[model samples]
Target: MRVLIAPDKFAGTLTAVEAAQAMATGWLEQAPDDEVVTVPMSDGGPGFVDVLSAALGGELLAVTVTGSLGEPTPATVLLHEGTAYVETSQACGLDLVPPERRDPERATTYGVGELVAAALEAGARRLVLGLGGSGTNDAGAGLLAALGATAQPDGVLASGGAALAEVTALDLAPARARLAGVEILAASDVDNPLLGLRGATNVFGPQKGVAEERRVTLDAALERFADLADRSLADAKGAGAAGGLGYALSLLGGTRVPGIETISAAVGLPDRARAADLVLTGEGSFDFQSAGGKVVSGVASVAGEAIRPCLVLAGQVLVGIREMRTMGVESGYSLVDLVGRERALGAPRDSLVELARRVARTWSR
Candidate 1:
């Protein structure tokens, strides 16, 4: 039997490559005779550059850039041909800020702009930015600022929705000239709009540490930014992703495309899974989001078309067997339930491997 293992990163626990290795080890221990192939995957959020770089050989270019907190940090971008892949999370990811200091109002994407500048300086003709895991709701104002674009100073130029109220002007001439010939692609997984209740501020503000009472203020701020940009936030799908970074990229001539679709096509996942008897996939949590165009769902869709049973192993499985069955997942397993939540949370890698081995043993029988 040919088994294909393709799983996303276990969020804060393990990377996609690490998860694939653990799964492969367990499968080999239990099903020694079965041919197992590992294909690490991401939703074009965090770890996108690393996963894509590994799958398609690329050179890693590291440059010094500012962090979300305005501190200087080293950020890496993947260079493939004339196109440079930049994962914004490397500069402004939520993980970089501590829980106590996790205020979206204070974070900035200036570092992301720096990354783009570095890529441009390196002679990259095109830029692919994975926009997710962001800690700010600046609507890419800070990013533009870093790229030499002018914006209203003072008040809140970096933080949550309230900051949008202070924006008095926008000057993109510098950025336009700097990136005149470069094509920018803003890869995102979410389809949230830019304004209103379902827009960037209202939908993602709380998660980024915006208080409930402050949501409306932030939402309105994003609305103003959208207006200033001469674009209707509500009309753009994925405009709310990365805290209105999608909208910012759109104004900057960046094309917004389904992250999973882009990654899947780049990695040739569908072609590989077509020849496999069983395709294994997973994520941090297998919930409704999995069905909403995540990597796992994307892989399952392809596997289903090829008539292959797609098995799943998650860190925590919220969806039951019946729910997952509808998405072409024949069977689902969870490390949290198998090893107990405490143990599973403590050492995810070992727990995941053991759970995979146990599942493989069951398959062998």
Candidate 2:
């Protein structure tokens, strides 16, 4: 039997490619005679470029950009034909900062803007910007600055969320000029608004180390920046992605699209699933959000359309069995269910291998 294995990054544990490899190892260990095809998937986040590059066969152009804390960071931009693919996480992801050092107040998306500028210099007209895993909450103030929105005179623009308070005026005309003919698409799985409880600051700021006491101030600062930019785009979907990088890109005519849909279509997942005998996909956690424009749901949709059974394996299964079935998933295997949270998080590769072996014995037939 031919098995197609594709999974998203298991967050803090295994990446998409690693997840697929582990599942293949386990499946092949049990059924060595069976064939396994591995394809990793990402919902426009950390592994977006790698996944697309693998599928699209592109030239990877390397450039130096700023990290979240203003250090020189090396990043890759995938150039396929006339389109350029850039993942924000490659430059300013939260993973780049250690847990103790996380400070959204000082984080910046300046590197992301640098990547876009580099892509433009390469003659890219269509920009696919994957917006996730960001460490900043300055509402793209740093990105705007990098794209030529300095604070007037020789004074530099403030670095992070806190400095947005001093952004008395912004000049996006230069950026607009640079991106005049470029088509920007902000790919994001979340549809969070730019400001409010579900907005950038309150929902994502804590993850980037913005203390509870400082959320209001950062939110207010973002509100002020939005007031100066476009106050009406606050409620737009995807506006809150990557800690408000979505809202930032929108300033340059960036439109939002579901991350999973964008990636699936670009990589031809529907066609791949149609030709596969069985489809296996998973993620770090299969929860309520898994059904809402995430990698698992997107994979399941394509598999279902092909009348193929799609099984999900995860670190934890927060969504119920009925709900999982309703999403067209044949079943789900959980590391937490087999072992425990500690083992699941600490040794996910082993647990996943065991789970896949068991699934092959029980479900593979």
Candidate 2 runs further than 4 Å off: 152-158, 339-343
Candidate 2 residue 324 C-alpha distance from true site, Å: 0.8
User: How well does candidate 2 match the true structure, expressed as C-alpha RMSD?
Assistant: 1.8
- Write candidate 1's Cα lDDT for 97-201 as tens digits: 889988787678888989999999888999989988998787887777777777676534454445678778877778777878789988888888888788877
RMSD of each: 1.9, 1.8
Residue 49 of model 2, lDDT score: 94
Q: List lDDT for all candidates, in order.
A: 0.83, 0.88
lDDT of 1 at 245: 82
TM-score for each model: 0.94, 0.94
Candidate 1: stretches off by over 4 Å = 153-161
Error of 1 at 247 (Å): 0.7
Worst 10 residues of 1 by lDDT: 153-162
Compared with the true structure, the alpha-carbon lDDT of candidate 2 equals 0.88
Clashing residue pairs, backbone N/CA/C < 3 A, model 2: none
Candidate 2 lDDT over residue span 85-145, tens digit each: 9999998999888898888888888999999999999999999999888888888877887
